[model samples]
Target chain A: MRTIGLEDIDDIALGSSLLGSGGGGDPYMGRLEAIAAVKEHGPVTLLDVDEVPDDWTVAPICGVGAPSVSLEKGTNGIEYPKVRAMMERMLDTKLDAFLLSEAGGMNSMVPISAAARAGLPLVNADGMGRAFPGIQQDTFTLNGVSTNPFVIADEKGNCTVLYTIDNDWTERIGREITTASGGQVTTLASPMTGAKMKTSVVKGTVDYAQKLGRIIRTASDAQGEEPEAFFLRESGAMRFFKGKICDVLRETRDGFNFGKVTLEGIGEDKGREAVVEFQNENIYAEVDGEIVATVPDLICLVDSETFVPVTTENLKYGKRVLVVGLPCDPAWRTEGGLELAGPRWFGLDVDYVPIEELAARRTDA
Target chain B: MRTIGLEDIDDIALGSSLLGSGGGGDPYMGRLEAIAAVKEHGPVTLLDVDEVPDDWTVAPICGVGAPSVSLEKGTNGIEYPKVRAMMERMLDTKLDAFLLSEAGGMNSMVPISAAARAGLPLVNADGMGRAFPGIQQDTFTLNGVSTNPFVIADEKGNCTVLYTIDNDWTERIGREITTASGGQVTTLASPMTGAKMKTSVVKGTVDYAQKLGRIIRTASDAQGEEPEAFFLRESGAMRFFKGKICDVLRETRDGFNFGKVTLEGIGEDKGREAVVEFQNENIYAEVDGEIVATVPDLICLVDSETFVPVTTENLKYGKRVLVVGLPCDPAWRTEGGLELAGPRWFGLDVDYVPIEELAARRTDA
Candidate 1:
């Protein structure tokens, strides 16, 4: 177990946004909420998956719906604990800990606030190492965990308990309810025992996020090691390209922000172009007509100067950015994971080849 | 108290269809399902609202969403009972009886099947004497009954329990979920005690429906008392108009069959035109440019020859029909009721003048 104080929140938020891969919503509001909660309640205790007792119940808590809506409306900070209390009432048992649905952007900070306010420990692992659009894209779902007995709550104290047949129905019903509940809702779902959590979750993501954030915050040109090189080395990520965003096309569809961005090469590789497409998160990336990164892997764009991550809604024309690709947790490489989060599932007309394999092929060429 | 056997299903179905006011969906499938359930589970016991024990819990059971979709994806006779069971689990108490949300078409029959199958009594009363599109249109809503703790279930055995701040949110969330659950969902909401039921519900609607059906089936040209005349006299209804449908325009919007139908008067009323507009149920009727009938009253179109009710989906050009307007229950005349089910609520221009007043004006003329 470890402690996450107010001082650690900024680093965690920065790293979480980087892992958001241009989605999972912006972290500014969640960061403020978490800071306030921690200041008022106390530092949140973080328990690694292995530290939890086998019988303890851990639930993933996060927000679902359009990120833009959440930005405008903002949470009242009361919804998360209420969601946890509702879940406890439904299950007739106290929750042992709260887990992050994704180690990305606002979601990463939300559970911290919930845990701090509720006086419970926050689990160190997460369902997704990086953000994905749909609920069924989680590692727990790929590992055969049922996303049943889900609770959705709004700021008005209105709540809904949904029991669906599968993860897909959970997403469908959740999305509809979230949209109807004024575009966003806080949810607690994918309740699993500690044993299940240890097997299904991507471990140590919270610590990794904080570490990544600290590295980015301290690194400078005078330090001799560039922030991009440090991040790529530490996270085992591949540097895809360096370019200036030339164009961006975006539309809000079905409660999701869907868009594509074109990046014109700079400096060492002038005249070449790269394109990234996203639905809530970056799902596909291509450079000069060749697929470089796809879903089940993380594709992130960072501002060249500050190395701050650029979210999907923040991506605009004329911004200089560095694109990076990180290999996904091994669980996502399984057949079930591929079927759930692969290119075919997102309707991309290409097969999923691991980022490592693609990187190796480029090296050989 | 009364026992409703398979023999009574036909009459009940016929009367319920007339009460549907061109909505509530067609009763054919529900009638068939109820008949089979009754044959298998024995007759359904009917108790008047007054007969129910003061402490007993009674819930209004019905379906929400597009009637067209319900027709296409027929029920497997499993959803209603499951919804009741889910409610029982949530409340941690046994439900005493099932009440019809509306004494119209499919909903009227659905509760009978559910009660019979669950071995519970069916209350011979309903929230609405005739069908209304939205949940807030129910008399119970106007009588200060909260529509929280409602349950929505689907044929796939999926269920959602919603706790909303008010009836309006209930309708909004329920409708969205119903649409998402493949266009139709069975719901049980507005659970009330027998004392509340006696004051809030339209009592003895089952007996009234059966009596109306018997009269319509027996009366003919040979009997010298026309169906329309007998209906108006017995139900305190008005003979709105007699005409052949000249134009029927319909489009399904937000899980509701919404449109306008034009009828050309014949014989003594030749050259005069009547128009009826609807959203799920008939909301307005106008003849010769004057509003003759408006909700929260009942406006129905019946086949001139057989007196069989023509549902909104079945209404078409060249059908000879008689339009009748029935005075709504007194509960619906209250300010709260009108605000919820008035002409303005459906976006009509005119204010709601009670059907009795319109009929009285015609008599003075």
Candidate 2:
């Protein structure tokens, strides 16, 4: 187990945002909240999924809604713990540790605050190693873990407990409630036993995020190795392109930020263009009429200089960014996982081809 | 106390539809379900609010959503009981009786089915004497009763329990969930003690509805008494206008059937026109641009010949109908009630004037 102190907030936020795959919401506010929480309640203990006792119960907690709205509304900081408390009261069982629902974006940091406040340890693993729009698009769901009874708490302390038949219904109903509750809600769901967690969770993502954050932070131009190169080398990620954002189209539909971003290729890739489409999270990227990457793979964008991740809500015109692709957790490549998080699931006609395959095809061409 | 068997379904449906004020959804399906329930479980006992034991717990049960959708979707006959059972399990208290949430349209009959199935008594009173589009627009709300912890159940056996700060949040969040859960959900809320029920409920509405239904069913042209005249005399309602429908404009918005119907005056009122506007329930009626009625008062439309109530969903062209107005329950005229159910609350420019006062003004003019 590792302790997350105030000093670790920056690295965790930066790393999680990169892993957020351009969603999960901005981590700035989450970082601030975590700092305050750690200051007030001391450091939070982060436990590996395997370290948890067999009989222990772990619940995943995260914010669910439009990331843009979450930036404007902010959170009360009490929503997660309140939801956790309610769940415990309802179930008559103590939660052994708080699990991050996703190891990407602001959600990766949210659990730290909840853990600090509740004086509980946070599991180092997450349901999703990277972000996906719907709650059902997770390893736990693919592995047959139910998403209910789910608890959602809003800023006003109002709480809703949902018991649904399936994870899809959980997403449908939870989205509606979150939208109605002013477009942002903290949720605790998918409680699992330690044995189940060991198999279903994407393990070791918390420490990996912090390490990634450190890599981005320590990179120096004098060293001649770019932050992107370091990320690609360590994570087995592919550099899709380096480009300046030329245009962006975004709309809020069904409580999700959905749209596309167009980029004009820069440097070695000059004159070529690329487009990345997203629903809450960056889902797919096409480079000059060729599919470079698609979900269940990670399509991420980073600032050309600072290497800070550009979340979907922060995508802007005129900013130069490096597009990167990484393979998703092997669980996501399973038929059931692909059915839920694949391009076809998002209504795209193409079958999912891994990022490595696409890179090899590019090399051959 | 009274026993409501299969024989009572027709009268209850007829009377409740008249009280629905063009909303509440159609009572046909509810009546059929109630009949089937009573046939299988024997008759349901209806007890006066005062007859309930002072220490017993009472809860109102009803369906919430657009009336048009409820008709098309129909019910599986298990949602209400499921919600009630869930509520009992959550609260760890047995509900002594089931209370009707409203004494209008389909809602008036929903509790009967639940009560019959549960083998519990149905309270002969309701939160609303006439239907209002929102759950917060009720006597219980006006009298300081909270709507949480509200329970909603869908046909798929999925249930949601909401603990909101106030009744309005309950309506807002409940409506959102209902819309997402296929536009209709069974809800049991505003659980109260028997003593609170006596003061907060619109007492004797069940018998009143039955009596009004009998009046409508037994009326004959040979009697030389128009249905409107009989209705006005019995309920102290007023005949707003007599005309044949010329046009109907409808659109579903935010889970409600919102629109207006225009009527061309005929016979004694020839060359004149009238309009009835609705949002789920008819909220306003105007005769030749003069406001004849507005909520928190009742605006009803009936077939000119058969005297059958015309629900919002069934409003059609070329049907000769009589528009009627009745004063809302006196409790609804209170400051709190008006704030929730008044014309201004519905975005109308006018203040809430009692239907009797409007009738007097018309007579004076």
Candidate 3:
């Protein structure tokens, strides 16, 4: 697998936006910020956790809480340094590298920025393979890794490190501060040595992001080829529906951008109205009264013409979009996965269906 | 402060019902389970962090996610052992004691159960004087300690430990797994040593629980005294409104009992309707388009006659309930505290008003 450069992040952001469904926040600003950091510090080396040296201490870098604040307020890139310094001081040793906490939204780009700027190798994996609203939504926690000695950094340049004895306390304490900090804060936490990383971090996410990004970018550049088609070819995603956004209702409450976006279906499914409800991320997709796609699987909305991601805030009246569905990591498809990211979990009473099946049904009709 | 015995937990559970305010689930089973454990293992000692040895590690124990599950499928004493073992394994030494993560519902009682079984001292203080959802909502996390090394135990005998690099990760991962686990899991996390506990854990919560419990029990034993008056004397909580539940809409989603309970005001505030919204715990109270008692303060609902807590699920049409208001921990009333647990946080558009003031306004009218 090839490594990603700063220029490659644009494609990743675009693809991530599509994968984000209607809710990964705007990826452009996060992309720009990541690119700026990469440009200043040089391309970061992406290392598989298996390749990490046994002695190296690897820390996951990311942001927490409501994505609205993360997008609107932006990040200061301060926590990374403070966490690094504190961890080194506590252990009396220099750190080895950084890892992404997840593959969705600004958090996906945060570690890359921190890795490049800090001169540390970036791990190619994340805790959760996708986006979630809280901290403990990762496979590592499921596998028993604590998110501790966690450091929280605010734009005001205040950095506080918590060396808690347990992960729940880490969440309780961190949430209070993040809530107090107005629902968005950046941090470096859950420090583990490379040996632990191999067992815990999801392998090969960095390469996947780079490849996904590259394919989308290259396909768009080729002879009027559609970016959505390129992404479908590369990631095996299926176009579930094509429509124009008819209505969008949003409210900022509980530090989350919550509401629904309705789309009027076109083509074979013309006259069908579908509504997708969102809370920080698109959780449920319903076409008319029937459930089409639910969470734990990717339900992404791509620009009909260019395949660029159309975010929830940007989704508006008459904007044509192609809704695509991709199966989440197999782990997310488990009973545990369904419970965490399934339809019923989000308040819907439908079982999950793959985008491919939905597309096949649509095409058959 | 005087020590509390296992015998005292039942009375505390009864009194706490009044304080829980039509939420906080039913503390009876948890308290009974805890009492049984304490009776079998001997009374657990309650200690202040400052009284502990310098090197002793103190972990906070609590059940995360929906309390409804606690009523349906009782929680076994597991997380405390898992956390204690994890810490012991980490330091190659046994933990000296344990602490409650919060003071409300089964959480307050669970720690005593864990302490009794594990032969660990139970700290008198909790992270929150009452309950609020999310790991980051704790005063300890707000002050500095991030809840980490979070140990979660499921009834299926699966115990996962998460060490996120940050507190948000802890919340995310824990919540995700909690969703995966059907929303009722026990967690032992945010372990701080005795040194930090002195400054971090909210002091005297366990003893306070015992005292409050004793007051209610004693009053009832003497003359079946009103639970409301007992609460008022103990915590300075005031009677805000007397009413009957007119409407209740319940939806169990994401492991949280989220929805609204509407009360038809009686007495001086008669003819007016009030709605209190809750997610795991009550966060907002409003009456006839006016914000009454918001979060970061106590919103208790009692049986108009018995002054006992009525779980949201148990609240039925025409059930008489007294809505009592009590001051929150002054720390929560601060700007930081308000942001973390205030009314706006639960999606209401209003500033927080002290429960006392709201009660006074009612009396004045």
Candidate 2 vs candidate 3: which has greater TM-score? 2
Q: Pick the candidate with the highest TM-score.
A: 2
lDDT of 2 by residue, A141-172 (tens): 98889988899999987899999989999999
In candidate 2, the residue pairs with backbone N, CA or C atoms under 3 Å apart (3 or more residues apart, or in different chains) clash, namely: none
Q: Single out the weakest 10-residue window by summed lDDT for candidate 2 chain A.
A: A219-228
lDDT tens string, model 1, B1-365?
Answer: 98999999888888888888888878888888899889999999999777899999889998888876767777767787778887888778889999999977788889989998899999999888999999778888888898878898888878899988888888887888887798888998888888888889888888888876766676564256655666657655568888999998998877788999999997656899999999989999999988899998889998876777888878889999988877888877778878888888999989889887887887898
Off by over 4 Å in 3: A1-365, B1-4, B21-23, B53-55, B87-94, B157-173, B224-236, B265-274, B286-292
Off by over 4 Å in 1: B226-236, B360-365
Q: Which structure is stronger by lDDT: 1 or 3?
A: 1
Tens digit per residue, CA lDDT, model 3, B1-365: 33557567786666555445445557877788788887899887877656777777777887887777778777755556665775565455577788878777577777878888888778778887777777778787777786656667666545555556567666665675666555777887787778888877667776666666666555544455455566566656666678889888888775678878889988777998888887777777777866678787777776776556666657689999877666777888888777777777667777777877776686798
Candidate 3 structure quality by residue, lDDT tens digits, A165-256? 56655665566556656677777778787888788766777666666666666766765655556667876766667899889898876456
Q: Report backbone clashes per prediction.
A: 0, 0, 54
> Candidate 2, overall lDDT?
0.88
lDDT against the true structure, each candidate: 0.86, 0.88, 0.71
| Ranked candidates, highest TM-score first | 2, 1, 3
Superposed by TM-score, candidate 3 places the C-alpha of residue B312 at a distance from the truth, in angstroms, of: 2.7
Candidate 3, residue B67: the lDDT equals: 76
